[model samples]
Target: MAGEPAVTPVPTDDELVVVPLRHWWRWVGGAVILVLLGLLGWALADAKIDYAAVPGFFTHDIMLRGLVNTVVLAVVAQAGAIVLGVVIALMRRSANPVARWFAAGYVWLFRGLPVLLQILLWFNLALVFEDISFFGIWEEKTNVLVTAFVAALLGLGLNESAYMAEIVRAGLNSVDHGQVEAAKAIGMTPATALRRVVLPQAMRVIIPPTGNNFINMLKGTSMASVIGFLELIHAANNIASRNLQIMETLLAAAAWYMVVVSVASVGQHYLERYYGKGVAR
Candidate 1:
């Protein structure tokens, strides 16, 4: 027994104590109650209530256009946010103290402010400047759509960049200092080392959270409606008010939103899985 491994006898299956379902009857009874409640709801809402006006309302030009606008706004805003977020993330991690400070401050201020207030402030920014000229292109007017869309994009993108900076920074920091040192040991510059060694590894952490943020930004695009951007919710509100089928129209908007978010969720899940392969490091 001096160096021998200890051996233990395996127990029989019968020795295991398995708890039976004492609440089986409770579950059955609850299921029955739920079925009855559903039946009652169907009889009242689906059977008797009329939804004849819904198709007519939904098919209207305004609602269709509004839905289109919502899609466009979400896409554009997300694109801007992603690009700006990466830029901010890079700047925050820069070697210069001034660059780091300015990037950090931008993220802090925007993240701290309410998005609605940010949108409103942007819509009114034209009042202060009169006109914004970019590369000799002067904005002809400070119109509601232009102002509101710009404001919403800036507000959401800037706010999102702050949060993204933290995510990106975390991803970048997740990389081992040894990798950077190793790269330099092989004659790589800091920038080249980051590009070839650090960023690829950091992406495992960076991508999943950024996808979630993009989904959130898609939903947040609705805030643009406040400044007269005729997005889905705004259109639904208008349709419901004029026709008095408020519940139905609101429900329709909710349905569309649910569909969009659900699809985004599926995509996010797959992306997470794809990016997660490197996480064991």
Candidate 2:
């Protein structure tokens, strides 16, 4: 106030101050990454591959047939896996030691085995069992299992059941124990309680991961190619080999896979949102 230059306002704790900060190194790293990505894209574009073959893939009857087969295989295999998975999950959660052990052994064996190896094993199951008889009246040769569709379904479905069992168990575990007890107190049978009370809640936990698994199963169906199942990749392989446009055919197949995956992703998002309705946590 006296002899001091007019006092300037000092920033108080309540006043906001803007401080500009720069991380030059982070910017440099980002630039470098962008440059590398650009180069990679350019290289792919200029690569010595028959890009012309890719567009024709949409019109090719073989490709369309393979796509249909892939879709069918995915649906059938996933359906079987879901049923088997639920059963195994129930067994795993059972009070009986025998049932638990059986479920554990199944999960261990299937989860431990590589899916490719499992496919091969199922394909050659005829060597182990000469015939697969359903009943005295209904019988079939084990060789029947060697077919591409049968081999792929058995391998993928059985293998997926192991993963699904774990997933379902996790979902079941998410349910509150009190709910089960309450259901029992109300005189509902265990089966009725699970179906009516616990499962609905558990679905919130189950739907998202299960949707992801479905997508994975969709892609896994491509492996049926090894056994002459003319699924998408197998069909592409045949075309590529014949035309000597390996890269283009593969890219085409990859494009179709991406399209299917995108569609599945959209479906999963909606399903997750629906099931996640009441349970936002």
Candidate 3:
């Protein structure tokens, strides 16, 4: 075998000529979308809208007051919701049956009802109870105590708490049980373990949805107008009623909402990035 000459290896010019895939349909779809957008723009431009009124009402004192009210209500309600949610989340995970059942019922009742209906119910709570009494020492008529702002706060905060509870529960559940066990092994109390080991990590899961919920809360404040709480929409309605420039006033309100939502979105992005450190996006 050694005496046989090795046959010379022959090389062939066989190489793959990679061709990029052509998505002609994507270009066609894009063109169709552009055309539709152009048509929409043309229609809006041709409409009988008082462009001047939009800017005029944007800086109006009434609108400004409503904007402030909307912001305050959203911030306060969301803060309260977060606190209540954390409590409910913990309750749902408690060893005690009463706590768990109560938490479950709370979530079921609030989450099942529409937020608008809750707002209405809070506003009209006098029908259910004539007055709220504190050990007969202090008594106030339900109608008097539950003013428009108070009703809105109670409604939004309570309703949002149900949703926030679920969000929190999910975040807490996402954490590995081993981590909690490890914390317990290290002489950490349950509270300390939750605080130090669990929540900080859970935040990565919690923040995105919570931020979205906050933004939705801002928009949800508009529903407060139904009870005459004078939020942005209510203010716009008032001005439009007198001036007969409904479209313009509403558009101005829409612009303010867009501005606020845009700012909140930017903040959410940074917050997510902060919490998402060392995690693959």
Q: Compared with the true structure, what per-residue lDDT tens digits does model 2 show for residues 1-281? A: 78989878988987977788989999999999999999999998898976777889755788889988988988898889889999999999999999999999999999999888999889889889998877677888888646878999999999999998998999999999999999999999999999999988888888888889989988999888888889899989888878888778888888888888899899899988887888675
Cα deviation at 79, candidate 1, in Å, is 2.0
CA deviation > 4 Å runs, candidate 3: 1-20
Please write out the lDDT profile of model 1 over residues 108-197, one tens digit for every residue: 898899988888888787677765566776555555444666787877777787787788888998999998999999999988998899
- Per-candidate TM-scores read 0.78, 0.90, 0.92
Sort all candidates by lDDT, best to worst: 3, 2, 1
Residues 15-101, candidate 3: write the lDDT tens digits: 546689999999999999999999999999999997877899998899999999999999999999999999999999999999999
Ranking by TM-score: 3, 2, 1
TM-score of the candidate numbered 2? 0.90
Worst 10 residues of 3 by lDDT: 9-18
Candidate 1 C-alpha error for residue 216, in Å: 1.7
lDDT of candidate 2 at residue 55, scale 0 to 100: 89
- Comparing 1 and 2 on lDDT, the stronger one: 2
Off by over 4 Å in 1: 1-60, 134-146, 279-281
Candidate 2: misplaced stretches above 4 Å? 1-17, 23-26
Flag clash pairs in model 1: none
Q: Which pairs of residues have clashing backbones in candidate 2?
A: none
